[model samples]
Target: MPAPTEITVHQQSRVLEIAFDDGTRFRIPFELMRIYSPSAEVKGHGPGQEVLQTGKRDVLITALEPIGHYAVRPEFSDGHASGLFSWDYLHKLGSQQDALWRDYEARLAAAGKGRDDAMPGKAGGSCHSH
Candidate 1:
């Protein structure tokens, strides 16, 4: 995996930009990053245990902390600071943003949910039990 050579946080536009050693540049919206966060709160601890994240349409990246040389931990405005975005994950996010977004929308629909209907930076808390 290509490690990030440069990382920038655009607070004004609420985006995180990263340039990889392989020359790939990614500009990811903070909202997207928040929803896709690798934290156990979002991704869970194992396969099939993934949780659907919601209400993060207005989330912000309050800070980015470097974790050694392998990853970055982003502090969200909502106080979610657990996700550690590794280089490979970040690259995948940049490259597959559209697909991931579509999947998210589909999941929401299947769950009888809507992004606009969710409260700010919330998760599956509002989802009804099947």
Candidate 2:
């Protein structure tokens, strides 16, 4: 994986732009990154325990703070700031976004949940259940 030389957050557009030292650039939508967050809250504690994040369609990242040169701590407007996105992880997310997103949508469909139904602070709404 290539190391990011610069990361920029476009608040208005709700996008995170990552540029690597190898001249590769990725522009990831905030909603996509938020939904695929690697945090335990989203990934759960083990396999087959991943929680589906709903109501995040409108979620936007408010801040991106660098943690050394390897990772970034993203702060979402929904008050979620636990996920520390690493360079490799971000790259993976960017690369596999389409498949991941499709999977997420399929999961939601299987669970009878809609993206708009995942409101913040609602119990049994959206969470990791490992």
Candidate 3:
């Protein structure tokens, strides 16, 4: 997988602009990142246990801490900071943004919820599976 050559957080645009060593560049929205976080709190332990994220339209990356050379841990303004975005995963997310956004919208519609809707009850518990 191509590693990231650059990663810039555009706070005003609410997007993360990433460029890879392979010459591919992507501007992934912050909303998309939060909803598709690879954390266990979002992905769950196994199939059918995934948690749907909501009200993340304005989520911000408070911090981006590098986990060695392979991944980066993002601390979102919504208090979620568990997902460690690996180089490969980030590449995938950037490459699949459009399809992923469509899927997210479809899931929200299926659940009768909106992107700005607050999650029902409290958020899910933390897990190290990320």
lDDT of 1 by residue, 1-130 (tens): 7999899999888889999989899899888898889987777667766677777877888889999888899999988899999888899999899998998899889978787565445556633344
In model 3, where do residues sit more than 4 Å from their true spots?
123-130
For each candidate, what is the lDDT? 0.84, 0.84, 0.89
lDDT of 3 by residue, 15-57 (tens): 9899999999999888888999999889999986788899999
Better of 1 and 2 by lDDT: 1
Worst 10 residues of 2 by lDDT: 121-130
Evaluate model 1: give its TM-score. Answer: 0.86
lDDT of 2 by residue, 1-130 (tens): 6899888888878889988877878889888888888888888778877778888877888778889878999999988899999999888887788898899899989989997785446567455333
Q: Output candidate 1 Cα RMSD.
A: 3.7
Error of 2 at 59 (Å): 1.3
Error of 3 at 20 (Å): 0.4
Name the TM-score of candidate 2: 0.87
Q: How many residue pairs clash in each candidate?
A: 1, 1, 0
Which residue window of length 10 is worst by lDDT in model 3? 121-130
Root-mean-square deviation per candidate: 3.7, 2.8, 3.2
